[model samples]
Target chain A: MQLTGGQMVCESLIREGVEVIFGIPGGAILPLYQTLPEYPKLRHILTRHEQGASHAADGYARATGRPGVAFATSGPGATNLVTGITTAFMDSVPMVIVTGQVGRSAIGSDAFQETDITGITLPITKHNYLVMTAEEIPAVINEAFHIASTGRPGPVLVDIPKDVFEEMGEFEYPEKMDLPGYKPTVHGHPNQIRKAAKLIEESERPVILAGHGVIISKAYDELMELAEKAQIPVVTTFLGIGSFPDDHFLSVGMPGMHGAAYASLAIDQADLLIALGMRFDDRITGDTSKFAVNSKKIHIDIDPSEIGKNIPVDVPIVGDLKLVLKVLNERVKPTTRVDWVQHVEDLKRDHPLMHERDTDELLPQHIIQQLSELTDGRAIIVTGVGQHQMWAAQHYTFKEQCSLISSGGAGTMGFEVPAAMGAQVGRPDKVVWSIAGDGGFQMTMSELATLAENKIPVKFAIMNNGFLGMVRQWQQIFYEKSYVATGYSRNPDFVKLADAFGIYGARVTEKSQVKSAILKAMEHDGPALIDFVVEQEENVYPMIPSATSVASMIEEPKPEEIRQ
Target chain B: MTTTESPKHTITALVEDKPGVLNRVSSMFRRRGYNIASLAVGHSEIANLSRMTFVVEGDESTVEQVTKNLHKLVDVIKVSDVSIQNCVSRELALVRVRANVQTRSEIMQIVDIFRANIVDVAPDSLMIEVTGDEDKVDSLQNLLRSFGVLEVMRTGTIAMDRGLGDEQTDKDNSSSTHRMESGL
Candidate 1:
């Protein structure tokens, strides 16, 4: 049973059901890479950068609901994964990160390629370890995977020195993780569940604020049943985009800063709020003083810490959403609310979220809307942060649970390219598209080379605006239109960039060419990109000004009509 | 969510006796912007487990968040906010004071009244060791300050519940026995 630390890693990961590892090999990690060829079952996708590797792992985890794995060398390579690691931490994505360090004797000696990755990722990861000896490798790796994939899942890092990887170890995998401090509560208290059920049955106007926890717990069916049984409208948070079907009858759409007007309005008027697996982020409840003013909240989450962290709750049930909802569904009375539904409908009709359709210039919303329909509203849509992210969330109708994989908590600018590639790799059966803004596209367009090399078939839809559209809109609204460094007027040709990667590329500057270009990219096979030249100054509507009440959401701009 | 500040609360935790457990606990306090009034860490009653006591200053919600976040760490075994419980807390301080011939008797009188022991004696200085609550230590330091207190070393407060609750908790919660059975 003697094995090298590198073999123990491979064997442990195999036992954990890891089929692929997204990573890059370097000086410190060479020992592990040398052993990688011996194990062909672990498909290693070589990314251009460690950042891309970590983000791809995040995307894979989000797409599959399994812990995604990433590997990197120490020093700069490990530091580069910081943003991606923080992104997963913020969004609660399950990821296991393995980093190679310098030889044990050379550690902390300013040795080449030696960095304290476990220390650097301490605040972000659920748990992390620095394997001191070859013997601890198997157990540490097992614990890393277990911690990453359990409870309120987040990334976990395990740092291994080069000497340890080369040293021999007894490699029996630990079947169970025995960390006393790591137990997660899964079942709800009966009293709390009963209180929630009573609240649900009594309230005339109820809105279910479904957050990312629902998706992580895969409580889609239970959520639907609860909403149906109680006839409550469901409003998803940005990260909770596809937790419930976008086209479901009870779906009122997303609610937040740039969320749907009707969705926010519904929350403003609701008598009771059932917040499931979603934290009351500031973005969701802008100006917490006035948010859901009259609603009594029932917060259910596996993490006890998240309840009352932001928004105060009336009935807080600490447990897994699926189990809590199962009991809650059993206790609640089934009834329909006609007046509440009609009121929400009226709000939806009064404050519809729409983009300018009469314009001849290619609108990003139009392109996303068209793409959503063309792909049958089933493609896994990933987006970079900015105007394009909001546009995609608003325009595209997500029909499947966890179908939209985008940076929510971290809001990383260059998330689209690599995350889409990872999603496509994880779910080969589903079509994956990267809808990125022009400014964010250039930040990580190098990932396109990884896409082409791996033949990852992720379609790219770059919303080619001349500026960082979101920032530009903010400046226009708040800073007297001084664009500053927000303009990327001399951006590179995205089609040409895609072509350089040996991927099919197309350009669409008019509305007429949009559908055809998307179709052409879809037909090209391996990987494809389409550059849609969108309006330069388009704004995401129904935006509640930063930290303000949803009551201050700007439906349409008025000249000198600024509120006090 | 409450930004209002309040008096300090004594929080205690039983954590794994790992090399970086203290760093993990302290780092989270700094990251979450929770101010630490004082901290004490030592070997606990159980083998391979360390108990940490932190006096943190924040409002109800913020302190609740601090405890919750601390519990989130995989190395932390159990946490208790002893401020809300019937707990006995103590701090140990060794105060070195300028004890000249004229002030020596006066300093001895003060130390005797405070029930403190003069652990070390020098020609012009006396080191008094006092073990009590923080307030008692603070009072002793104040009395010795006029004698030109040369230096002082203080161990931050440690606390324990004054009942059977803690003993029962330790019996039920100690996972020190739950070790990873490494065949190596």
Candidate 2:
């Protein structure tokens, strides 16, 4: 059937299983907007800002593992999507961004509302396509989803020229994509797999380093089996929380700049390291030369380029995490090395990971633990970066991989709320908790409309510390507490902000009310935010200060010493 | 095996074949880090697929990596560990030599011994095409140095097994079987 380019977009999206689109209408995208009402199943969210729309789409994708779709007009509309797109790219989330453009003729002429959206987003997106005709729109959208969700799994953009949307053409979507040059490696090389197994068998102490790739590839079961079979302890990177159950005997929890000291110590002591689906980012491997010095590393990842790019590997297996782990699990023997396991247990005991709040005020860590208890591991908790993010990372014990999908590498501030939106899209049946600090929540507060429009019941736990908590903590530790722009005066009542968007909200000032507020928000049928007026000065502790000398660590001084 | 010093090197292979063959052949190379030193593919014996010769460099470990990976690509019909296997590895180079009366005779005499053909003869320039192993190519170019060679276009090393006939089929080398046999 022949349809206008704009109508083709809405129809193609429906075909791709896209039910909700978060965007703001503009002149360039008026053609697409005209056909939205016709598709009753397609829900279009009118966001306060184009940035908010893009983030909502990002949140949706992150939550569900389905490609999230966002719409925007040309020029400024496209520009606003850049931050959210970059965030998605950094975190490796799949998204199909549809943006309206000026006609092909006015592209280089610098016409009004005409911006080079493709060129501007070239570095961030995995791949982008410009649809010159209506016939290409369906195929392009199909290809975009396939590319975005498969292989390395990153964001893909599709820019439609305004004139193309106005023209009529036959609609057809392909069942499969055929790109000759774009073949992703799926199976591991047999030799590399063998080498990894042999190394694990020979070593006295073997450790499994889990990362987000396990979640992305859905290899949690494989990861658990490998760890149990090899009789090795498992440690996760910051973004790798919930990759293995925290309650598992072998699971050592998160390890990195903010990781438990014992986890870092365990990494330092291992003889053979089996790194699964995790990139050894600089933050995770603080000093590369000193990281796992006694260990011969076996790095398994789907992206071939990432294998030897960071730390050199003795055995490198390039393939899907699930496939690779399955093979490794089959080859690995179920041998019990009681000594090595006991050693890790000893370290865990000596350097126990704990949180202590020596104050009468309600601490942020207390609130996070309370949420964890209240939800009973059934909720998906997302967090923005800063002291609060680290505090949650330290305190809230996650139960599954992808349950906590916060921005770890990019440390993007406004990640939690939007990512919560994405997580909710993925898991509509469960309670989605977006845990943010006062500073991070406000960064993308405009996304409240996205939740209101979709009626996605994501409860917001905003730890209102009245400052950029991480930066403020650094100031307190390094610069004698001479706070800068981190401090802000009394801000807008978040409850009112939520109310304005036609969503439920509450504010809690005292320690007694925090749990009740969270319970109330969780009970509400729709999207809600709870503004917890948390104590501002509490610091995320046991932090391994970014040291100049590897041997020394400047631990946080006692609160009494800081007063002097 | 008892040698205190044995420097390991790599062999370059040029093959005529189809697509999906790379995954099959590279799967033969046991190590994943077996770097493809330089693989230049172009038109060769067949028109549909083309020929590719990859130069891989490494120690003994790298050789294992190369052989194991080569067998992984579906389209690769065969892989030769030519570095150790007896094979005549050769390359072709076309040189545009500056031909003057003074040194032309000497250049021609040297070319005759190298078995080089003078494809083009101009009043002041002579274009010669030479094909040989690494040593022969190097010697011929060295002998042509006195004649003032102006330009040279050399195709990257393309190779085949030393003695070749329809002896081995692509199916004979099952990647899975070969990998299991190698105990990878």
Candidate 3:
């Protein structure tokens, strides 16, 4: 049957089981928008900006483990998706970005709204394509989804020329992809698995350093079983927060820069480090030479390149983490490291994560703790990057898998709101919260309209500190407190801004108002915003100075020295 | 493993003949802070597959990392470090140099010493084509420079292992199984 390129895109998405998409309409993408009414089953949520659409799709992907779909127009519309696309790319979130381009003839002629999106997004995407004909739409869409969701999932872009969207052609979606060079290894080598098991059995102080791969691979049960069977303590990376139950006896907590001091000390002291599905990012490994200096590392990652790219591994197993853990769980013998567990407990007690509450002013840490307590550590907490992000990671205890969704690799500011909306849309049953600092919230607060329009009940907690808190902290600690562009002299009344968007809003200035305001926001049927005016100059502690070894951590100052 | 000096490495990769594969490969090198000395790419024996050869200047670990990272790309089929292999390598260079009435004969004598061909000749300049190992091409380019070489374009090294008879053995050795077996 003959179909237009726009129809082919819709049909292919339907065939791929995509039920929802986030996009904004514009001149170049008018054809797709015109055909949208024909397919009522595929729901399109209109976002105020392309960046919001892209981030919402990313949040949806992270929540559902499916490739989220997003659409944008040519040139500026497509360029706006760059930040979101890079965020998804850095975090390995599966996303398919469909962008409209100028007509085939006008591509490089600099026609109206014409941009080389494929060229610009080349490095940021797992793969991308430029379609010149309508007949190629189905195949391109199929390939785009497949490539985006396959091994080491990431964002893929498919740019279609406007003429192709209007052209008529035969449409057929291939049942099987003919990508011979794109095979991903899913099974670990038996020898490597056996060697890793041997290492697990022999080691006395073994620690499982879990990363985003654990959640992506859905290896939570296997990870838990391995930890239980080997009696090994688990320390999660920033992105790996919810992979292991935080309340579990074997779970130590997050480890890295701004990680729990005890967790960092445990990683430093471990004799054997079993790294699962996580790249040793620089933030996690302060100084590569001194990171886990005493440990014999066993790295298991689906991407073979990540195994030893950062840190040399003693036993490198290249395959899917879930499959490898399943096999290793069966072969590995049950053992106990009583002394190691006790040592971790002792360290945790000595260097606990706590802030002084001697002042009457509201503290961000206390508010986050209240939220965690109110939600029983079960809500899907999405946070933008900054001081509040680190505070949330430190205070909000995540007990469920895939619960904490944040921009870990990219550390993108303004990610929380749209991402929280996507998460709420993806998982309507769960409680979703977007925690943001003052600076990051202002970056993409325009998405508050998208939430109100869609009636997506994503509660937002703005830790308003009146400064770019994280950078301010760095300047205060590293530099001579030259506050440059960090401070915002005049800030908008957040409550009034939220009310302007037709959503419930409240401002909590005193500590007494924090709990009631959060409760009120949680009870609201639709989107709500709570502005918690937190202490302005707070810093994340246990920071390993840049280019320094993890062993040399800057501990929190004496409580008497802290200014209220 | 403890080498202090950076060494030149010859890397060969098999990739799908798809759009942006070149950009993907080159951008990775640039983004990862690796230097590409020279690069050559052409269609391979197989259908829809292209072969890419590039020379990189890095230590042993960096070269190892480069090969592993190239393999991570979905478009890349296989990656091999041919620097340590018993292989026959060749590069093609086209050098355009000044060939005035006085220097024409002298240039011809030097070209003859290197067994190169004069592909194009103008009144003032001659373009010579030469194919050999990197050293041979480098020496020829150096000698041509004395004659005021106008421009030089060299195809980076394309290498293949010495006859393993089946020839496919090299491909098999470059497979993931071989990589796993070799503990790389």
Candidate 4:
């Protein structure tokens, strides 16, 4: 059937089973917006900003196992999506970005709203296309969706010229793609699996270091089985928080900077580190030379390049995590390391994650604990990067796969609000919470209006420390406490800001009010914000300083010593 | 850990002949912090595909990582570290030298010794074309430098596996031919 390029886009999206897209309509994309009404089943969310649209799409993609779609016009509209695109790329989220460019004749003339989005996004995207003609719309759309959703998924952009969107063409969606150069290996080689199994069987101190790959590959069950059958401890990376049941006996919580001290100690003492679906990023591996120095490593991932990209591995298996774990689970035998388990328990007992309860000031950790308790540890917790992010990662007990969605690799601030909106929209049945530090919250607090506009009942918790808490912590520890620009002399009244957005708001200055504020936000039935005024100088403990090994973690000072 | 001297490596890739494929491949190298000494891209044997050859200076681990990263790109069909393989390599350089009537014969003699051709001639300059490995081209350029070489343009390094049967041809027949026939 013959259809205009804009119509072809809608048709192809329907074919790809995309039910909703987040974007704003502008001059170049007016044709698409005009055609959008024809397809009543496809929902178009009008975000206040292009960045919010991109991040909402990303959140939707992460919450659900489907590729999220975002749309924008050219130039500034396209550039605004760069941070979200890089975030999806860094975390390997499946997303398709559509941008409308200037007319073909005026593309190189630097016409209004004309940007080389394809060129700008080249390095970050898995693949991108610039459509010059309407005839190529259907095929390009099909390819964009295919590339974005398959083989270690990431973002893909399709920039359509405005003229082409108005032109007519024969619309034909191919049933299957014939991408010869883009095949991903989905099964592990038997020989390599066996070698990894042998390493698992022979080692007495085996530890399974899981990462976001575990959630991406949907191998949570397999991961649990492998950890259980081998009787090995499991420690999750920051993004891998929900991959394993936190309350399980084998679970050792998170490990790295701001990770549990026991988890870091366990990794340091392990003889075999079976890294699954996670890169040994610098945050997880404090000092590369000293990171699991004695452990023989087994790294498995879908992307072959990630196998040896960081620390050297003795057995490298390149394939899907679920498939590799299934094979390894069958080959490996049930074993127990009673002494190793004892040592881990002792470490946890000696170094418990705690704050000074005697202090009258409201604590961030206390607020998180109350929020987690109020939500029954089941809310989808999303966070902006900083001290609050680390506090949430340490405090929240995530038991659901993909329940905690934070910007890991990019460490993007202001990611919490819109991402929570996306997550709430994707999973309406579940409660979604956006936790941000004072510094990070102000970055995108405008999204509170987005929440009220969309009526997305995502709860918000802003840790009001009155300073850039993480940077201040670093300055205090690394420098001579030169406060510099870390401290904010004044800040906006968050409750008033929320109230101005027509959302329920409250402020909690005392620890006694933390629980009630969280419960009130949860019961609001609409978006609500709770500003918890936390201690300003408080720091995240068990920090492995830069260039130092995990063994050199700095813990909280003793109460008696602090008094002196 | 054992350390080795970083050396120049000739790498070749077969990629789908599509818009922005070159940009995608080049950007991958740049993003990964790999220094590309030279790069050349052109049509290959099959339609809708192009062959890219580039020289990179790196150690064994860096080269391994470069190849692995190149393979990860969706447009790249095949990546080969031709430097390590038993292969035939060549680079073409067009050199313009300051040669007058007096030094013209001397420059020609030196070019002839390297089996090069003087493609263009003028009153004050001569354009010489030399095709060989990097070292061979380097030697001729060195001898011509005494005559004051004005300009040099090199088509990096292009290579093919050396054997009775071409590995790329065999691999392409099994995997890439069907896609080309499908016209995707």
CAPRI classification of candidate 4: medium
lDDT of 4 by residue, B1-184 (tens): 0012338887999999987788888888888899898898889999999999988888777888999999988889999886555456678999999998899999999989888999999999999999887778998999999999999999988877655344455454334324322321
lDDT of 3 by residue, A160-236 (tens): 98888999999888887877668888999999999999999999999999999999999999999999999999999
Ranking according to TM-score, highest score first: 1, 4, 3, 2
Candidate 1 segments whose C-alpha is farther than 4 A from its true place: A557-564, B1-6, B166-184
TM-score of each candidate's B chain against the true B chain: 0.85, 0.63, 0.83, 0.85
Q: After superposition, how far is residue B177 of candidate 4 from its true place, in Å?
A: 31
Give candidate 3 regions above 4 Å deviation: B1-6, B96-110, B118-127, B144-150, B165-184
List the candidate 4 regions with Cα displacement exceeding 4 Å. A560-564, B1-6, B100-102, B164-184
lDDT of 1 by residue, A280-347 (tens): 88889988888999999999999999999889999999998999999999999989898998888898
DockQ of each: 0.72, 0.05, 0.54, 0.66
* Clashing residue pairs found in predicted model 1: none
> Model 2, A1-564: lDDT tens per residue?
889999888888898899888888888889889988899899777777777777778777766878888999999999999988988887788899999999978878999999988777765777777777788888888888888898878888899999899999998778887564356788999888988889988999989899888888889889988888888999988777878888788989777677777788788888988898888887777667776778999998877666665578899898999998898889999999899889988988877655343656877888888988888865788888898788788778787567887877677888777778767876888789988888888888877877897787889988898998889988987898999888879888888899999999898888888778888888899999998888888777566666321244434356565334
**Lowest summed lDDT window (length 10), candidate 3 chain A:** A555-564
Off by over 4 Å in 2: A547-564, B1-184
- Model 4 superposed RMSD (Cα): 5.1
> Candidate 4 residues A1-564, lDDT tens each?
999999999999999999989998888988988999899989887787888888889999999979999999999999999999999999999999999999888988989888889899988888888898898888888988888887788999999988889999998888777788888998999999999999988999999999999998999999989988888999999989999978788889999988999999899999999999899999988778888987999999988888788789899999999988998999999988899888888988888987455777677887888788888888899999999999999998787788998999998887887788888889999999999888888877777787898799998899989998999999988997888898889899988999899999999998888887788888898999998888888888879997688768998777554323
TM-score of 1: 0.95
State the displacement of the C-alpha of residue A482, model 3, in Å, after optimal TM-score superposition: 1.5
Task: Rate residue A68 of model 4 by lDDT.
Answer: 91
CA lDDT of every candidate: 0.89, 0.77, 0.89, 0.87
